[model samples]
Target: MTDTTARTIPIEAFGPGAQSVDVPVLDSHLHHVEAGEGDPIVFLHGSPTSSYLYRHLFGLLAGRGRLIAPDLIGFGDSGRPEIAYDLADHERYLDAWFEALDLRDVTLVLQDYGAAFGVSWASRHADRVKAVLLAEPVIRDIESSALPEAFVGAQRVIRTPGDGEKFVVEDNLFLTAVLPGAFLTPLAEADLAVYQAPFPTPESRTHLIRFPRNLPIDGDPASSVEYLARNEAWLASSTDVPKTLLTYEPGFLVTPTIVEWIRENVANLEVHAGGAGVHFVQEEQPQGIADAVVALLARAEAR
Candidate 1:
């Protein structure tokens, strides 16, 4: 029924990641892996990538605590239903996951596209969040995005032209554009298969197709306008939560101007070495990120 022609990608793996990997019988409900034993920390992956994205973090934190990372629906080994994907859809999944696992005292490690999903969840369940680590995270409204012009122009091309829907998600250019920018090093050719494995059909790209244009810039793109507003309000008022921006070396997210916007606009915000590290700082600087998270938890524990 599905095309098997996609090249098999050897998704990166780490034996040293988390101490134990227990996949509950949840099935395609959400492709997940759990390691270690302690307070639960769920890592949410960005679009076009799966739990495989956190391969390094799993190893780093598995020993000190519990780690759970899931592939969002239509992204990884998870089921790709024929449905529209949006911020609310992702929030629903996050709620179900936390409730299903009975998660509490959580620390969220979010990056890239995952920022939308994780930030939405944090805002909704503010009391449960213990701390936060955001790397090259997306927090801008559509108009304010500091992402390269090339990237934004492509987004406009694919979403406004009506025909943008066809290629935005399905075009190999999406993968080409995102890969080298986010990770510290050029991803191996084999790994590209893992990232590209999920969307094998035009229909399956429903979420990928819709994700970009949904940006809430200048409130033009109706759907995302409100979401960006809600998330910003939450971030601005989340004084009780311990929030840290683990930047990368020269960061891979929007641009420096945008980063300055976050620093000046966002309240209760702190910074780490995120802007100075590689794109996959979690992988390249897993220990430092993990240490920062643990320290946040420790502060929470102390409180």
Candidate 2:
């Protein structure tokens, strides 16, 4: 059902490595990237993707602030824990990882599933979060299709009886099939290499296959649904968290109506639109996103 031919993302093509280290998790080394100086900005990525998502951001902001992007337990160079991976898994990982580094006064930047981890983590430590920037995070329901239309049937397909692995396929419809011309900007060949590096083998994609099992839309996608329920309640009551909606060229999957709905709603939300791409903004416009994050931080400071 999968290919074992380890696909290589030519290492030379990637941007410079800012800083690299590993978190101790048994025999596995959780690869992490640290760059920049001053206040720390810990980035959390979602399923099937790793710190590779922030290669450009890392390069752009490495001199401005300390950037720490890690490969979650089941993805990238991290140890595949052989356990089910989901939001709760990410929450625990973020809790422990940040604690290990003693990260404080963070400007947590998140996107996609990263939103779930970063937001949930920030809500737990409101005093630590200075500001936030999100690219179609997993804040609301998946069907909302506000961030990326890649949401709708992807989860539905994978959660089926035997189609679990389909969602994590190397040539994922989300990226190759659906994302082709839709994502904000086409990913640079170098950047695309990073996102494509983790799943070198079909069998190594166990996490990818299982990632779909964690979607909370269904009855109980993963164990974190309960935590997500709690996080939603927190998002509703908490007014201290400064959040922004950075919109790019999204596809029909995420109709303008859905994104507009968020633009109209959500308190303390600043929505900016001026680019194009189906979903992955970090890929197409890395510098733009980096600037936007810095700008949002300034806005939060002014208020």
Q: Could you list the CA RMSD of all candidates, in the order they appear?
A: 4.5, 5.3
lDDT of 2 at 151: 51
Candidate 1 C-alpha lDDT tens digits along 7-84: 222233744443222223233354566677887787877756777778777666666667877777667765555556
Q: Count the backbone clashes (under 3 Å) in each candidate.
A: 17, 13
Query: Which stretches in model 2 have alpha-carbon errors above 4 Å?
Result: 1-17, 25-29, 144-155, 166-191, 216-226, 251-265
lDDT of 2 at 234: 51
Q: What TM-score does each of the candidates earn?
A: 0.82, 0.80
Best by TM-score: 1
After superposing candidate 1 on the true structure, give the runs of residues whose Cα lies further than 4 Å from its correct spot: 1-12, 16-28, 142-145, 181-184, 217-222, 264-267, 275-280
In candidate 2 the C-alpha lDDT for residue 278 amounts to 46
As a TM-score, model 1 comes out at: 0.82
Tell me the whole-model lDDT of each prediction, alpha carbons only. Answer: 0.66, 0.63
lDDT of 2 at 248: 62
